[model samples]
Target: MPGGLALDTILPSEIKERLSRGEQLTIIDVREDEEVAAGTIPGAKHIPLGQLPERHTEIPQAEEVILVCRSGNRSGRALGYLESLGYKGLKNMTGGMLEWED
Candidate 1:
């Protein structure tokens, strides 16, 4: 958790529930391509953590964006970076795919 107490988080179950209810969430998978090849959230966009600085614009600024990774670490860092750039409505998916699959 890069922001520690300031980092916002949403559980995998919560995301699934929202999607089930037809909520169109903006989920960004910050994991690398190889890791993503294994699988990912149903509709999450991939933007590997390292590329975020240059690819951040691809993410929506007006919607609630959920950052996800292998665990929760990288996405947390991604959230912090975006926050520094003044991006709002950002959340890190807690436990990432590991918990998502669980």
Candidate 2:
């Protein structure tokens, strides 16, 4: 991650606060369809980790993208990939959905 956008972890509480303030942010749930069917944060977009490479262009280039998954690991990986692709303001939701609903 040297000289690159190191993966950043943001707490769910922080996400909530920023949204409450009406900040326009993008939350990308990297979980598969089955897991996402259970639930996802309000306003989050679904882009399974497996399909990310082909569909990465679907994500807006100018927006900050926050990634989420069953746990933080997958999303962290997604963050690394996206960062490598030159996406900025990218972050992983620390603890992922597990912490978000806890």
Candidate 3:
């Protein structure tokens, strides 16, 4: 793994700024349907973590993919999996939706 993979984390503030500026990014919510029904980050794609390994190709190859969950932990695990699969430019949204709302 490249050292940059070790740095694959983003703050909610940074994501907010990117969205506000109309920057294109692939924001993925890896939480379950029940969790998403409660709330989610605007414009995020729903791909529950359990489905990632099988649905990996559904994720774009040439985009900055931000993984999110209720908290940062799950997303971090997702990031590791994606990295192991050679997915580039994957970033875990730090503190996930919980921090993003704060």
Candidate 4:
């Protein structure tokens, strides 16, 4: 897996800026529906981590996929799985929603 899977390691602000600029990226929220109801990045697609393996087909393999969770831990695991499935352009939003709140 790529080093980008590490939690607590934030993606640089510049990279985030690029994402905000409408870069062709896929931001996926891996939190459960209840957790996402609390809050989520605007426009993010919700695909609970538990369902990712079977639902991988729902996600586009070509686009850059940024995984997010409550604390980034689950997303890191999802990142690894996605990598094993040969999905490229994977990224974990470190610190997850906790850091996003910061």
Candidate 5:
């Protein structure tokens, strides 16, 4: 995290704004099923962090993708994992769902 190699990040508000503006965003929620049951960004695809190894291929590499979790930690990890596999246009949702409002 000390180097410039850190993954890019987007705030929850920014994501909400983009979605509200009719942007076709690809958001992947990496929280567990129970955590996601509480609520999530509408239209986000649910893929738990544990399942990403096998399910990551389902994500698009050519388009921007936002990763989310209860907090930013898991999503950051998810972003790193996907990046290692050559996926581009990835961003970690800073503060995650904890800072997401509706």
Candidate 6:
């Protein structure tokens, strides 16, 4: 993840646990194309940070939404934006792929 994470965040393990229980999840990856080429959480929808403002409609209004990025930086910002747009269940994946890659 980034050097310092803000208040709202989620851990990869917690996401994994919910998935294990067969819960429906909406995961959005806000990483850039080049960053996404490396890999991303399975089932995540790719909506680059730059495109989120315009494409936010494409994202489902699920009660829970997991936002991911390379180091959680972009995703964190995305989460905040989504919140302003009336998204209630948005969460930034803490550490992003950095911690998940571990």
lDDT for every model? Answer: 0.92, 0.88, 0.87, 0.80, 0.90, 0.86
RMSD to true structure for each model, in Å: 3.0, 3.8, 3.6, 3.9, 2.8, 3.2
RMSD value for candidate 4: 3.9
Off by over 4 Å in 6: 1-7
How does candidate 5 fare on TM-score?
Answer: 0.90
- lDDT comparing candidate 5 with the true structure: 0.90
lDDT of 2 at 50: 95
> Per-residue alpha-carbon lDDT of model 6 for 1-102, expressed as tens digits?
468545577898888888889887899999889988999887889999999879999987657789999888888899889988888878889888998888
- Model 2, 15-37: lDDT tens digits are 98999999877899999999999
Candidate with top lDDT is: 1
Q: lDDT tens digits, residues 1-102, model 3?
A: 355435778889998999899987798899999999988888999999999989989887667899999888988898888888888888898878888888
- Which digits, one per residue and each the tens of the lDDT, describe model 5 over residues 73-97? 9999999999999999999988889
Q: Which pairs clash in the backbone of model 2?
A: none
Off by over 4 Å in 4: 1-16
Worst 10 residues of 3 by lDDT: 1-10
Best by TM-score: 1
Rank order (by TM-score, best first): 1, 5, 3, 2, 6, 4
Cα deviation at 59, candidate 1, in Å, is 0.8
Kindly list the per-residue Cα lDDT of model 4 for residues 1-102, writing each as its tens digit.
375444423463544687779876578899999999998887789999999978888888876778889987999999899888988778888778887776
Query: Which stretch of 10 consecutive residues in model 4 shows the poorest summed lDDT?
Result: 5-14
Error of 1 at 5 (Å): 8.7
